[model samples]
Target: MDYSEAIAIADDVHWVGRYDPGRGLQCNAYLLHTQAGAVLIDPGSMGDFPVVFRKVLDLITPEDLRYVVVAHQDPDVVGSLPVIAEVAPEAEVVAHRETARLLEHIGLRIPIRAVPPEGGFLPLADRTLEFVATPFLHSPGAMATWDTATRSLFTGDLFGAVGAPWSLFAEGAFESQLTEWHEVYMASQQALVYSLDRLMQLDPERVCPQHGSVLVGDQVARANAHLRTLRCGIDRLVSA
Candidate 1:
Protein backbone atom coordinates (compact mmCIF):
# COMPACT_ATOMS: atom_id res chain seq x y z
CA MET A 1 0.00 0.00 0.00
CA ASP A 2 1.19 3.54 -0.69
CA TYR A 3 2.32 5.03 2.62
CA SER A 4 1.71 8.54 1.31
CA GLU A 5 -1.87 7.97 0.27
CA ALA A 6 -4.87 7.24 2.45
CA ILE A 7 -5.78 3.55 2.31
CA ALA A 8 -9.46 2.88 1.96
CA ILE A 9 -10.94 0.95 4.90
CA ALA A 10 -14.57 1.02 3.82
CA ASP A 11 -16.73 2.92 1.35
CA ASP A 12 -16.17 6.35 2.86
CA VAL A 13 -13.44 5.71 5.44
CA HIS A 14 -9.66 5.66 5.00
CA TRP A 15 -6.70 4.65 7.17
CA VAL A 16 -4.40 7.66 7.47
CA GLY A 17 -2.02 6.16 10.08
CA ARG A 18 1.73 5.90 9.72
CA TYR A 19 3.71 2.72 10.48
CA ASP A 20 7.11 3.54 11.96
CA PRO A 21 9.89 1.08 12.71
CA GLY A 22 11.46 0.30 16.13
CA ARG A 23 8.55 1.82 18.02
CA GLY A 24 6.78 -0.84 20.08
CA LEU A 25 3.78 1.46 20.44
CA GLN A 26 2.44 2.13 16.93
CA CYS A 27 -0.56 4.32 16.28
CA ASN A 28 -3.44 4.21 13.78
CA ALA A 29 -5.53 7.18 12.63
CA TYR A 30 -8.54 7.18 10.34
CA LEU A 31 -10.49 9.59 8.11
CA LEU A 32 -14.17 9.44 7.35
CA HIS A 33 -15.69 11.35 4.43
CA THR A 34 -19.06 12.64 5.42
CA GLN A 35 -21.59 14.80 3.59
CA ALA A 36 -20.40 17.81 5.59
CA GLY A 37 -16.75 16.91 5.03
CA ALA A 38 -13.87 14.86 6.52
CA VAL A 39 -13.92 13.65 10.11
CA LEU A 40 -10.49 12.87 11.57
CA ILE A 41 -10.08 10.28 14.33
CA ASP A 42 -7.01 9.89 16.56
CA PRO A 43 -4.88 12.32 14.53
CA GLY A 44 -1.76 10.68 16.08
CA SER A 45 1.23 12.27 17.83
CA MET A 46 3.47 15.17 16.76
CA GLY A 47 5.93 12.55 15.45
CA ASP A 48 3.16 10.96 13.39
CA PHE A 49 1.45 14.24 12.52
CA PRO A 50 3.41 14.86 9.32
CA VAL A 51 2.57 11.52 7.75
CA VAL A 52 -1.02 11.50 9.04
CA PHE A 53 -1.64 15.08 7.92
CA ARG A 54 -0.26 14.32 4.46
CA LYS A 55 -2.61 11.36 4.16
CA VAL A 56 -5.54 13.57 5.07
CA LEU A 57 -4.37 16.10 2.47
CA ASP A 58 -4.34 13.32 -0.11
CA LEU A 59 -8.11 13.08 0.23
CA ILE A 60 -9.31 16.56 1.16
CA THR A 61 -8.13 20.05 2.02
CA PRO A 62 -7.94 21.19 5.65
CA GLU A 63 -11.08 23.32 5.27
CA ASP A 64 -13.21 20.24 4.63
CA LEU A 65 -12.49 18.68 8.02
CA ARG A 66 -15.63 18.68 10.17
CA TYR A 67 -14.89 16.91 13.45
CA VAL A 68 -11.82 15.73 15.34
CA VAL A 69 -12.42 12.74 17.64
CA VAL A 70 -9.90 11.71 20.29
CA ALA A 71 -10.60 8.19 21.60
CA HIS A 72 -8.73 9.05 24.82
CA GLN A 73 -6.51 11.89 26.01
CA ASP A 74 -3.20 10.10 25.29
CA PRO A 75 -0.58 12.20 23.55
CA ASP A 76 -0.28 9.71 20.72
CA VAL A 77 -3.96 10.18 19.94
CA VAL A 78 -4.50 13.87 20.64
CA GLY A 79 -1.08 15.46 20.15
CA SER A 80 -1.76 16.38 16.56
CA LEU A 81 -5.27 17.59 17.38
CA PRO A 82 -4.27 21.20 18.10
CA VAL A 83 -2.74 21.56 14.66
CA ILE A 84 -5.82 20.02 13.11
CA ALA A 85 -8.08 22.42 14.96
CA GLU A 86 -5.80 25.25 13.89
CA VAL A 87 -5.88 24.25 10.23
CA ALA A 88 -9.55 23.48 10.29
CA PRO A 89 -11.11 25.91 12.69
CA GLU A 90 -14.61 24.63 11.96
CA ALA A 91 -13.91 21.15 13.21
CA GLU A 92 -15.46 20.39 16.59
CA VAL A 93 -13.58 18.52 19.30
CA VAL A 94 -15.47 15.35 20.23
CA ALA A 95 -14.47 13.17 23.18
CA HIS A 96 -15.74 11.63 26.41
CA ARG A 97 -16.31 14.26 29.16
CA GLU A 98 -13.53 12.85 31.30
CA THR A 99 -10.99 13.27 28.52
CA ALA A 100 -12.16 16.76 27.71
CA ARG A 101 -10.69 18.15 30.92
CA LEU A 102 -7.13 17.39 29.82
CA LEU A 103 -7.69 19.14 26.49
CA GLU A 104 -8.12 22.38 28.45
CA HIS A 105 -4.49 22.27 29.58
CA ILE A 106 -3.58 22.33 25.89
CA GLY A 107 -5.51 25.67 25.76
CA LEU A 108 -8.39 24.34 23.68
CA ARG A 109 -11.45 26.56 24.06
CA ILE A 110 -15.03 25.65 24.76
CA PRO A 111 -18.12 24.38 23.30
CA ILE A 112 -16.19 21.07 23.35
CA ARG A 113 -18.86 18.45 22.93
CA ALA A 114 -18.81 15.52 25.30
CA VAL A 115 -20.11 12.25 23.97
CA PRO A 116 -22.72 10.97 26.41
CA PRO A 117 -21.46 8.42 28.93
CA GLU A 118 -23.99 5.82 27.92
CA GLY A 119 -23.65 6.48 24.17
CA GLY A 120 -24.20 9.34 21.77
CA PHE A 121 -24.47 9.88 18.04
CA LEU A 122 -23.34 12.77 15.84
CA PRO A 123 -25.45 13.39 12.77
CA LEU A 124 -23.60 15.03 9.94
CA ALA A 125 -25.57 15.52 6.76
CA ASP A 126 -27.16 12.09 6.30
CA ARG A 127 -24.53 9.88 8.01
CA THR A 128 -24.13 9.38 11.73
CA LEU A 129 -21.15 8.55 13.95
CA GLU A 130 -21.70 7.05 17.39
CA PHE A 131 -19.60 7.21 20.56
CA VAL A 132 -19.49 4.54 23.28
CA ALA A 133 -18.03 5.56 26.62
CA THR A 134 -15.48 2.98 27.87
CA PRO A 135 -14.34 4.57 31.08
CA PHE A 136 -11.31 3.05 32.91
CA LEU A 137 -10.45 0.45 30.29
CA HIS A 138 -7.12 2.20 30.44
CA SER A 139 -8.19 5.70 31.55
CA PRO A 140 -11.28 7.02 33.21
CA GLY A 141 -12.42 8.86 30.08
CA ALA A 142 -11.41 6.14 27.62
CA MET A 143 -13.93 5.36 24.91
CA ALA A 144 -14.54 4.12 21.36
CA THR A 145 -16.17 5.61 18.27
CA TRP A 146 -18.41 3.78 15.83
CA ASP A 147 -19.34 4.69 12.27
CA THR A 148 -22.82 3.33 11.89
CA ALA A 149 -22.83 3.46 8.11
CA THR A 150 -19.76 1.25 7.79
CA ARG A 151 -19.99 -0.70 11.04
CA SER A 152 -16.42 0.39 11.70
CA LEU A 153 -15.47 0.57 15.38
CA PHE A 154 -12.60 2.97 16.18
CA THR A 155 -11.37 1.73 19.53
CA GLY A 156 -8.68 3.50 21.58
CA ASP A 157 -6.17 1.49 23.63
CA LEU A 158 -8.66 -1.19 24.47
CA PHE A 159 -7.61 -3.51 21.61
CA GLY A 160 -4.07 -2.26 20.95
CA ALA A 161 -0.95 -4.50 20.69
CA VAL A 162 2.81 -4.39 20.34
CA GLY A 163 5.29 -6.54 18.36
CA ALA A 164 7.83 -6.62 15.56
CA PRO A 165 7.27 -7.59 11.88
CA TRP A 166 3.77 -6.23 12.30
CA SER A 167 1.39 -6.45 9.39
CA LEU A 168 -1.29 -3.80 8.84
CA PHE A 169 -3.87 -6.40 9.70
CA ALA A 170 -3.83 -9.00 12.46
CA GLU A 171 -2.15 -12.16 11.11
CA GLY A 172 -0.80 -15.42 12.50
CA ALA A 173 -0.44 -15.48 16.32
CA PHE A 174 -1.91 -11.98 16.41
CA GLU A 175 -4.23 -12.90 19.25
CA SER A 176 -1.33 -13.63 21.57
CA GLN A 177 0.22 -10.24 20.84
CA LEU A 178 -3.15 -8.51 21.30
CA THR A 179 -4.12 -10.40 24.46
CA GLU A 180 -0.70 -9.94 26.03
CA TRP A 181 -0.76 -6.20 25.39
CA HIS A 182 -4.09 -5.84 27.13
CA GLU A 183 -3.07 -7.92 30.16
CA VAL A 184 -0.18 -5.53 30.71
CA TYR A 185 -1.62 -2.20 29.58
CA MET A 186 -5.27 -2.40 30.54
CA ALA A 187 -6.34 -1.40 34.08
CA SER A 188 -8.30 -4.54 34.90
CA GLN A 189 -10.27 -7.44 33.50
CA GLN A 190 -13.52 -5.97 34.82
CA ALA A 191 -13.07 -2.77 32.81
CA LEU A 192 -12.05 -4.79 29.78
CA VAL A 193 -15.08 -7.06 30.14
CA TYR A 194 -17.49 -4.16 30.52
CA SER A 195 -16.21 -2.34 27.47
CA LEU A 196 -16.06 -5.54 25.44
CA ASP A 197 -19.65 -6.32 26.29
CA ARG A 198 -20.78 -2.88 25.12
CA LEU A 199 -18.71 -3.16 21.91
CA MET A 200 -19.98 -6.67 21.10
CA GLN A 201 -23.49 -5.28 21.04
CA LEU A 202 -22.47 -3.23 18.01
CA ASP A 203 -21.40 -6.40 16.14
CA PRO A 204 -18.99 -4.25 14.20
CA GLU A 205 -17.82 -5.26 10.76
CA ARG A 206 -14.30 -4.04 11.34
CA VAL A 207 -12.30 -3.09 14.43
CA CYS A 208 -10.02 -0.04 14.01
CA PRO A 209 -7.87 0.51 17.04
CA GLN A 210 -5.43 3.32 17.92
CA HIS A 211 -2.35 1.16 18.52
CA GLY A 212 -2.51 -2.05 16.53
CA SER A 213 -3.42 -3.77 13.28
CA VAL A 214 -7.03 -3.43 12.20
CA LEU A 215 -9.27 -6.52 12.64
CA VAL A 216 -11.99 -7.53 10.21
CA GLY A 217 -14.48 -10.35 9.63
CA ASP A 218 -13.80 -13.43 11.77
CA GLN A 219 -10.72 -11.84 13.30
CA VAL A 220 -12.93 -9.44 15.27
CA ALA A 221 -14.89 -12.20 17.05
CA ARG A 222 -11.78 -14.26 17.70
CA ALA A 223 -9.82 -11.33 19.15
CA ASN A 224 -12.82 -10.25 21.20
CA ALA A 225 -13.11 -13.71 22.74
CA HIS A 226 -9.39 -13.93 23.38
CA LEU A 227 -9.34 -10.61 25.27
CA ARG A 228 -12.64 -11.20 27.10
CA THR A 229 -11.20 -14.04 29.18
CA LEU A 230 -7.83 -12.55 30.12
CA ARG A 231 -7.23 -11.19 33.65
CA CYS A 232 -5.46 -7.83 33.61
CA GLY A 233 -3.63 -5.41 35.96
CA ILE A 234 -4.58 -6.08 39.61
CA ASP A 235 -6.76 -8.98 38.64
CA ARG A 236 -3.84 -10.76 36.97
CA LEU A 237 -1.69 -10.28 40.11
CA VAL A 238 -4.42 -11.38 42.52
CA SER A 239 -5.11 -14.51 40.48
CA ALA A 240 -1.37 -15.28 40.38
Candidate 2:
Protein backbone atom coordinates (compact mmCIF):
# COMPACT_ATOMS: atom_id res chain seq x y z
CA MET A 1 0.00 0.00 0.00
CA ASP A 2 1.19 3.54 -0.74
CA TYR A 3 1.99 5.31 2.50
CA SER A 4 2.53 8.76 1.04
CA GLU A 5 -1.15 9.46 1.51
CA ALA A 6 -1.08 10.70 5.08
CA ILE A 7 -3.93 10.43 7.56
CA ALA A 8 -4.18 13.39 9.90
CA ILE A 9 -4.28 12.43 13.56
CA ALA A 10 -3.96 15.94 14.89
CA ASP A 11 -3.44 19.47 13.64
CA ASP A 12 0.24 19.01 12.81
CA VAL A 13 0.79 15.28 13.06
CA HIS A 14 -0.08 12.70 10.44
CA TRP A 15 0.12 8.90 10.15
CA VAL A 16 1.63 7.90 6.83
CA GLY A 17 1.59 4.26 5.80
CA ARG A 18 -0.55 1.16 5.49
CA TYR A 19 -1.44 -0.79 8.57
CA ASP A 20 -2.38 -4.07 6.95
CA PRO A 21 -3.99 -6.95 8.74
CA GLY A 22 -2.11 -10.30 8.72
CA ARG A 23 1.02 -8.64 7.42
CA GLY A 24 3.95 -8.99 9.78
CA LEU A 25 5.96 -6.26 8.07
CA GLN A 26 3.59 -3.32 7.93
CA CYS A 27 4.10 -0.30 10.22
CA ASN A 28 3.34 3.42 10.55
CA ALA A 29 5.49 6.56 10.30
CA TYR A 30 4.61 9.88 11.88
CA LEU A 31 5.20 13.39 10.51
CA LEU A 32 5.57 16.29 12.92
CA HIS A 33 5.41 19.86 11.66
CA THR A 34 6.82 22.73 13.65
CA GLN A 35 7.66 26.34 12.98
CA ALA A 36 11.33 25.40 12.81
CA GLY A 37 10.56 22.76 10.24
CA ALA A 38 9.25 19.17 9.88
CA VAL A 39 10.43 15.91 11.45
CA LEU A 40 9.64 12.30 10.52
CA ILE A 41 9.74 9.49 13.02
CA ASP A 42 10.74 5.93 12.00
CA PRO A 43 10.36 5.99 8.23
CA GLY A 44 9.48 2.26 8.19
CA SER A 45 10.70 -0.31 5.61
CA MET A 46 12.14 0.92 2.32
CA GLY A 47 9.50 -0.93 0.34
CA ASP A 48 6.69 0.69 2.33
CA PHE A 49 7.99 4.27 2.57
CA PRO A 50 8.72 5.94 -0.78
CA VAL A 51 5.11 6.91 -1.37
CA VAL A 52 4.88 8.47 2.06
CA PHE A 53 8.13 10.36 1.62
CA ARG A 54 7.02 11.76 -1.72
CA LYS A 55 3.67 12.77 -0.27
CA VAL A 56 5.38 14.45 2.67
CA LEU A 57 7.49 16.52 0.29
CA ASP A 58 4.37 17.54 -1.57
CA LEU A 59 2.80 18.90 1.63
CA ILE A 60 6.03 20.46 2.87
CA THR A 61 9.02 21.01 0.66
CA PRO A 62 11.94 18.68 1.24
CA GLU A 63 14.12 21.66 2.02
CA ASP A 64 11.90 22.44 4.98
CA LEU A 65 12.60 19.09 6.58
CA ARG A 66 14.84 19.76 9.56
CA TYR A 67 15.09 16.37 11.19
CA VAL A 68 14.46 12.68 10.46
CA VAL A 69 14.52 11.00 13.84
CA VAL A 70 15.40 7.29 13.78
CA ALA A 71 14.00 5.79 16.95
CA HIS A 72 16.08 2.64 16.46
CA GLN A 73 18.64 1.15 14.08
CA ASP A 74 16.43 -1.68 12.87
CA PRO A 75 16.00 -1.63 9.13
CA ASP A 76 12.25 -1.70 9.41
CA VAL A 77 12.53 1.54 11.36
CA VAL A 78 15.45 3.31 9.61
CA GLY A 79 15.80 1.36 6.37
CA SER A 80 14.85 4.37 4.32
CA LEU A 81 17.50 6.68 5.81
CA PRO A 82 19.49 6.68 2.60
CA VAL A 83 16.41 7.59 0.61
CA ILE A 84 15.49 10.31 3.08
CA ALA A 85 18.95 11.85 2.82
CA GLU A 86 18.75 11.83 -0.94
CA VAL A 87 15.51 13.77 -0.94
CA ALA A 88 16.02 15.89 2.15
CA PRO A 89 19.74 16.47 2.36
CA GLU A 90 19.33 19.55 4.50
CA ALA A 91 17.69 17.60 7.30
CA GLU A 92 19.87 16.34 10.12
CA VAL A 93 19.25 12.73 11.18
CA VAL A 94 18.58 12.18 14.88
CA ALA A 95 18.94 8.97 16.91
CA HIS A 96 20.37 7.66 20.14
CA ARG A 97 24.17 7.40 20.44
CA GLU A 98 24.17 3.64 20.02
CA THR A 99 21.89 3.82 17.02
CA ALA A 100 24.23 6.32 15.39
CA ARG A 101 27.22 4.04 15.91
CA LEU A 102 25.39 1.04 14.48
CA LEU A 103 24.28 2.98 11.44
CA GLU A 104 27.90 4.00 10.85
CA HIS A 105 29.11 0.45 11.32
CA ILE A 106 26.78 -0.61 8.53
CA GLY A 107 28.33 2.09 6.25
CA LEU A 108 25.09 4.08 6.08
CA ARG A 109 26.87 7.34 6.70
CA ILE A 110 24.51 10.24 7.04
CA PRO A 111 24.88 13.30 9.25
CA ILE A 112 23.30 12.19 12.53
CA ARG A 113 22.90 13.92 15.90
CA ALA A 114 22.68 11.78 19.03
CA VAL A 115 19.89 12.33 21.51
CA PRO A 116 20.64 10.88 24.91
CA PRO A 117 18.55 8.13 26.50
CA GLU A 118 17.74 10.04 29.68
CA GLY A 119 16.03 12.74 27.63
CA GLY A 120 16.79 15.64 25.31
CA PHE A 121 14.31 18.45 24.79
CA LEU A 122 13.95 19.77 21.24
CA PRO A 123 12.16 23.02 20.69
CA LEU A 124 9.65 23.28 17.86
CA ALA A 125 7.31 26.09 16.92
CA ASP A 126 4.19 24.23 17.91
CA ARG A 127 5.60 22.00 20.63
CA THR A 128 8.71 20.65 22.35
CA LEU A 129 9.92 17.05 21.89
CA GLU A 130 11.35 15.10 24.77
CA PHE A 131 13.18 11.96 23.66
CA VAL A 132 13.06 9.22 26.24
CA ALA A 133 15.60 6.43 25.95
CA THR A 134 13.89 3.05 26.04
CA PRO A 135 16.63 0.49 25.72
CA PHE A 136 15.91 -3.24 25.32
CA LEU A 137 12.24 -2.84 24.53
CA HIS A 138 12.86 -4.14 21.04
CA SER A 139 16.47 -3.20 20.48
CA PRO A 140 19.32 -1.79 22.49
CA GLY A 141 19.10 1.60 20.81
CA ALA A 142 15.30 1.74 20.90
CA MET A 143 13.83 5.02 22.13
CA ALA A 144 10.58 6.99 22.19
CA THR A 145 9.59 10.66 21.81
CA TRP A 146 7.18 12.70 23.89
CA ASP A 147 5.57 15.82 22.46
CA THR A 148 5.03 17.85 25.58
CA ALA A 149 2.58 20.32 24.15
CA THR A 150 0.28 17.65 22.75
CA ARG A 151 0.89 14.96 25.34
CA SER A 152 1.62 12.50 22.55
CA LEU A 153 4.24 9.79 22.66
CA PHE A 154 5.94 8.56 19.50
CA THR A 155 6.77 5.21 20.98
CA GLY A 156 9.01 3.04 18.80
CA ASP A 157 7.66 -0.52 18.64
CA LEU A 158 6.39 -0.38 22.18
CA PHE A 159 2.73 -1.40 22.48
CA GLY A 160 2.72 -2.18 18.77
CA ALA A 161 1.35 -5.28 17.04
CA VAL A 162 0.83 -6.69 13.60
CA GLY A 163 -2.50 -6.44 11.71
CA ALA A 164 -3.40 -2.96 12.89
CA PRO A 165 -6.07 -1.70 10.51
CA TRP A 166 -5.83 1.63 8.66
CA SER A 167 -8.65 2.85 10.91
CA LEU A 168 -6.27 4.09 13.68
CA PHE A 169 -7.34 1.42 16.14
CA ALA A 170 -6.82 -2.32 16.35
CA GLU A 171 -9.76 -4.02 14.70
CA GLY A 172 -11.50 -7.23 15.81
CA ALA A 173 -11.55 -8.43 19.39
CA PHE A 174 -9.11 -6.26 21.30
CA GLU A 175 -7.80 -9.02 23.56
CA SER A 176 -7.20 -11.40 20.67
CA GLN A 177 -5.32 -8.76 18.73
CA LEU A 178 -3.17 -7.65 21.63
CA THR A 179 -2.28 -11.11 22.85
CA GLU A 180 -1.26 -12.55 19.50
CA TRP A 181 0.76 -9.57 18.33
CA HIS A 182 2.40 -8.75 21.64
CA GLU A 183 3.54 -12.30 22.28
CA VAL A 184 4.88 -12.94 18.80
CA TYR A 185 6.58 -9.63 17.92
CA MET A 186 7.41 -8.24 21.33
CA ALA A 187 10.14 -10.55 22.51
CA SER A 188 11.25 -8.63 25.55
CA GLN A 189 8.27 -8.79 27.84
CA GLN A 190 10.25 -7.56 30.85
CA ALA A 191 11.62 -4.63 28.97
CA LEU A 192 8.14 -3.77 27.77
CA VAL A 193 6.95 -3.70 31.35
CA TYR A 194 9.80 -1.53 32.55
CA SER A 195 9.27 0.87 29.68
CA LEU A 196 5.52 1.05 30.30
CA ASP A 197 6.04 1.95 33.95
CA ARG A 198 8.42 4.71 32.90
CA LEU A 199 6.18 5.87 30.06
CA MET A 200 3.13 6.20 32.30
CA GLN A 201 5.12 8.66 34.39
CA LEU A 202 5.14 10.91 31.33
CA ASP A 203 1.31 10.87 31.34
CA PRO A 204 0.86 10.93 27.63
CA GLU A 205 -2.65 11.30 26.23
CA ARG A 206 -2.01 9.65 22.87
CA VAL A 207 0.40 6.93 21.69
CA CYS A 208 1.71 6.70 18.15
CA PRO A 209 3.59 3.46 17.82
CA GLN A 210 5.90 2.36 15.01
CA HIS A 211 3.47 -0.41 14.14
CA GLY A 212 -0.27 -0.86 14.37
CA SER A 213 -2.91 1.74 15.25
CA VAL A 214 -2.57 4.81 17.46
CA LEU A 215 -4.09 4.27 20.92
CA VAL A 216 -6.09 6.94 22.67
CA GLY A 217 -8.82 7.43 25.30
CA ASP A 218 -9.49 4.28 27.31
CA GLN A 219 -7.45 2.16 24.95
CA VAL A 220 -4.27 3.74 26.25
CA ALA A 221 -4.97 2.54 29.78
CA ARG A 222 -5.66 -1.00 28.61
CA ALA A 223 -2.51 -1.05 26.55
CA ASN A 224 -0.50 0.13 29.54
CA ALA A 225 -1.85 -2.61 31.79
CA HIS A 226 -1.19 -5.21 29.10
CA LEU A 227 2.43 -4.11 28.87
CA ARG A 228 2.76 -4.26 32.64
CA THR A 229 1.43 -7.81 32.58
CA LEU A 230 3.88 -8.75 29.84
CA ARG A 231 6.67 -7.59 32.14
CA CYS A 232 5.33 -9.72 34.97
CA GLY A 233 5.16 -12.71 32.66
CA ILE A 234 8.80 -12.17 31.80
CA ASP A 235 9.66 -12.01 35.46
CA ARG A 236 8.06 -15.40 35.96
CA LEU A 237 10.10 -16.77 33.09
CA VAL A 238 13.28 -15.56 34.76
CA SER A 239 12.32 -17.05 38.11
CA ALA A 240 11.35 -20.36 36.59
Best by TM-score: 1
Candidate 1 local lDDT, residue 11: 89
Please give, for residues 164-199, the per-residue lDDT of candidate 1 as tens digits: 766677787788788768988898888888889989
Model 1 weakest 10-residue run by lDDT:
108-117
**Across residues 1-240, which tens digit of lDDT does each residue of candidate 2 receive?**
234377777778887765555565467888888998998888877876666676676568989889888788887888788888887878888888888878876554458888876768788877888888888766788889998877889988777766434456554445545565566555466677777788889888889888767788678888887666663224435442
Q: What does the lDDT come to for candidate 1?
A: 0.85
The lDDT leader among the candidates is 1
* Residue 193 in model 2: lDDT: 72
- Model 2: residue 169 alpha-carbon error in angstroms: 2.7
Q: Give residue 136's lDDT in candidate 2 (0 to 100).
A: 74
Among all windows of ten consecutive residues in candidate 2, which has the lowest summed lDDT?
231-240
Per-prediction CA RMSD (Å): 1.7, 2.9
Error of 2 at 46 (Å): 1.2
